[model samples]
Target chain A: MAAGKRGNVYVVVGMAGAGKTSFLERVATYLERSGKPPYIINLDPAAMRLPYDANIDIRDTVDYKSVMSEYCLGPNGAILTSANLFATRFDKVVSICDLRAQDYEYFFIDTPGQIEIFTWSASGIMITDMLSAHFRTTILFILDTPQCQNPQIFMSNMLQAVSVLYRSRLAVILVFNKIDVASHAPLVKLLSDMSLFQSELEGVSDFSSTLTQSLHLILQEFYEHLKIVGVSAATGSGVEEVISVLEDVGAG
Target chain B: MNVFLSLRSTTNHGTVLSPRRAFAPTFSMPYAQLVVGPAGSGKSTYCHNVHQHCASLGRTLSVINLDPAADEFRYPVTADVRELISLEDVMEEEELGPNGALMFCMEYLEDNMDDWLAEQLEGYMEDDMVIFDCPGQLELYSHHSAFKSMTEKMTGWGWKMVCVYILDAQFISDGTKFIAGCLQAQSAMLHLALPHVNILSKVDMLQDKSVLEPYLCPDHQRLANELDERMDPKYRKLNHAIASVMEDFALISFAPLDISDEESLQFVLYQCDCAIGYGEDADVRTSRDVEYGDEPDMSNLSLE
Candidate 1:
């Protein structure tokens, strides 16, 4: 649906501390080093600082501080208002992307750290929808690996991932990030070895169990076909695998 | 002038005060369950847990998978949007690719709500608890009206609704991240404008409980100071504002849930029930019969 050569658009999504920016930086660096740097787009109007360069930054379209001053709102309120404004004038972003029609192979959107802006706001949806309408978009859902070490926490992460998958309605590649710190091997193995995890899976049905089996079962059922990959931004462990997944999804 | 005079005369005659008919009280809960959070924040997991929890207690609950691109699920789904409109189909049939297909799927789901969703929900009982495992798209919950419209439609059907917000507990270990988490949670609460429960999920993974000590019982000023210390001085004003809003709204403090601990899970459930006023309709009773005295005359002439 996207114009031009149907550029690959991967939106990296997660909470503020979920290493989205870091992951994007790594991916961009990797792509750049590999002679295929993406046209990076910064959709986070509230971001004070970022590690990567953006071809089309939301700040150029709407000044966050101006909105805050005009509306007498704080940063969060201003960001939401600005995002709403962006949704109304989404053509600007499209035009910017269109301007770079032939230069880039992929367009990477580094969204706002405010999850609500990216997940719940109409503007965020419009952005994703509009971009996808024109390009090949794959949602790269990042789960903080350190957070998933706990069974309950891991289940919660899966649910959130499912929610995003449904909301975005895009091909989602679930990435368990920060593996260097937390070592998500156990959780990844637990998920991969479905048969071995049957008892634990059954425990998800029993709310009274010490380990939550219901959470596991829900994740298992929701992402039965998806593969979970572990990566560490700090150590760059398993980053290549994630890139390969993206490449495969893009090719498909 | 003549019409105005006639209206005034009618108003003065008290004819407008007609006897009102006694209307029957409506007794139906709205069927809208809003599961919201960042991608990988555990909205679906919560629904599945709730379903399993209900089943354990001998209750029937159904989950509707609304993510078209969803490839996995740990809970049994009664309905799936993927069956109707998959991203792959959109890409292949329409030649739209992944993102375009995704948007198409969402629009298709929205358009077919009456036909597809209604048909799926038709078999459910009036009070059936249905949890919709929504997509990982954060826009839907934060600012999108799709879920809001969906909630409105579900409410029309007879279901009590609640928004279960899950935030990773590990992210809350630090003061700055805690503030960020709180701000995000508050934004969702305000944006959705629904009954919400903020959950600090994945407590079992916290290897060091001390890291979360300050956040567990948050002191806004202390947190602000800690944030000030960590962040650049230029953002001190912003930090103060955030801390103030957090304190004023009391928004981000979550009921910690360690699914690994059964007691923690139950406690979380109890809190959720209380939020929805789940069991407030039971009749109250008092025993009427009382024997003259079971322990009689302790101070009387018994010894004498």
Candidate 2:
């Protein structure tokens, strides 16, 4: 965010099965084809394999399974603990990224599969704060476009996004993934007008619909400041729009 | 003037002289269940099915709608909150959002318990059975004083109440989600401080019923082990802590409710009945013993 900084850090977070890693891989490939190769950091220790080779992989330093056995944690706990263990030595990682900042214009981070493990965990906060203090950082929250067609699921995702914004105090870009399966225009329309959401829930008598409608009204301010874009990881569509929006967000 | 007076007196006398049933339905002890849970957990469906089941058994139960935002009902509503105040009216008049409007509506209902709710409930006999369909918002039962005060006021009215907490079985497909649901139920229990019955609603939609068997009557050890296996080792203490707290309180077991099955609904109803000590105050008749003369002594009959 300063005049001297050359690289912008993007933290990709989303619910499991939301195609966060796939989106990151698409971004990496796009950046490479344009001759402006981005620095990719794989923070998810539990990832079996990645689509693109990460320059700095947490799995290289921390073995997720060994951490599980060593700490007597479950799979999720192991991932979180591995992230925590990796976060402690993050200063070294930051120094490396800083050294390469002169050459790299963009940095992409793939968080854990489970959204809360990265968004709600202390290690997540520490890593985010460290990166933001050193570079221009943004949270790329991926939403499953098809799954978000259900208003209940959509509201839950919005609440999660709002919580992340409040906690991190960082600029957020809501990336609706899986555009190949469904269009995000309806969701975009719902976000722009509160009355549409009310009418959408008009058929249901469940109090939850009312709750969701009320939540939409309460989230109007959050929606106003949010930067939204739709992309498909499988088809590599909407990449240009995402990159342009990222540039706009980075500049503003 | 005399003719007019005589005509009025004759009408009054005729009204007084008309044949009427002498016996008014006497109630035993009023029983009520406040159906509460998160959104889309099937609270209304539960109320509708339970009301129908009770009606088929020739039992009378009143269904009351307490959600001001509710637009429709499948069962015949005995008393509706929309009559007193609605979320729409509150939002339009007070210039409040939906959540704030809902809170205001509930608090308004709490304030009018003496005048409006009492009058609406005045027709019930002493032993009437009633089910209140409450809002699905978590805050109503968690920390809101409206529900707590309403409970206090209802108790003062000599009504035995049980909180029927519902959880969507489909949402709790994993070990961690199950633990989270238990914790939420326990939180509502601690907050309301009432006789609580947790129900796993919409069990008919579950893909495998056997997967939920262990959760119905949860084995503390097995639950903790499963929870530990699912969570990372760093949260091992937290997993164990939750399991132990659940076991100590003995309040986390859920009764499964399958609306399509009568037996399942009956079992769920039985649990709620047990929680409120329903049917414990009935007066048993011993008229047969009084009708028959005394027989031979029990000692002589045993010797033979």
User: What would the TM-scores of all predictions be?
Assistant: 0.49, 0.51
TM-score of chain B of each: 0.76, 0.83
Task: Give me the candidate number with maximum lDDT.
Answer: 2
Q: What DockQ was computed for model 2?
A: 0.03
Predicted candidate 2 versus true structure: per-residue lDDT over A1-252, tens digit per residue: 456655789999987678999999999999899999999999989787899989999999999879977977534456678999999999998889999988998889998776656754568878988998888889999999998886645655665675566446577899999999999999988887888887765553233444444445545655767789999999999999999998897775
lDDT of 2 by residue, B1-304 (tens): 3333432353353322112111233324478999998655789999999999878765678999999877779999999999999877887899754455778888899888767776676556554689999976665675566888787766655568999999888756656667756655654664566799999988888778777777877888898788667644544554555566567657588888888878677777777877887755432433221111222232221111
- Please name the candidate that would achieve the greatest TM-score relative to the true structure: 2
The segments of candidate 1 whose C-alpha lies over 4 angstroms from its true place after superposition are: A1-252, B1-26, B30-32, B123-127, B282-304
Count of clashing residue pairs in every prediction: 58, 7
Provide the lDDT at B70 for model 2.
77
* lDDT per residue (tens digit) for residues A1-252 in model 1: 333536678888875557888888887888899998888888888676778888878888899879977977534456777878878887777777776757887788887775656765557778887877877888888878876654534544555565565456566788878888888778777765655555544543223332233334434544555756778887787878987887787776
Q: What is the lDDT of residue A4 in candidate 1?
A: 55
Tens digits of lDDT, candidate 1, B1-304: 3333433353364323112211113343424466666555566777777777767765556888887766667899888887888766776799753334555677787777666766676644333467777765554564444676666555544446777777767656466556556645544554455677778777777787557666756788998798777654644654565566556555556777676655555556555555665544322211231121222322221111
Clashing pairs in 2: A73-B232, A73-B233, A74-B232, A77-B232, B27-B127, B28-B127, B29-B127
Chain B fold agreement for model 2, TM-score? 0.83
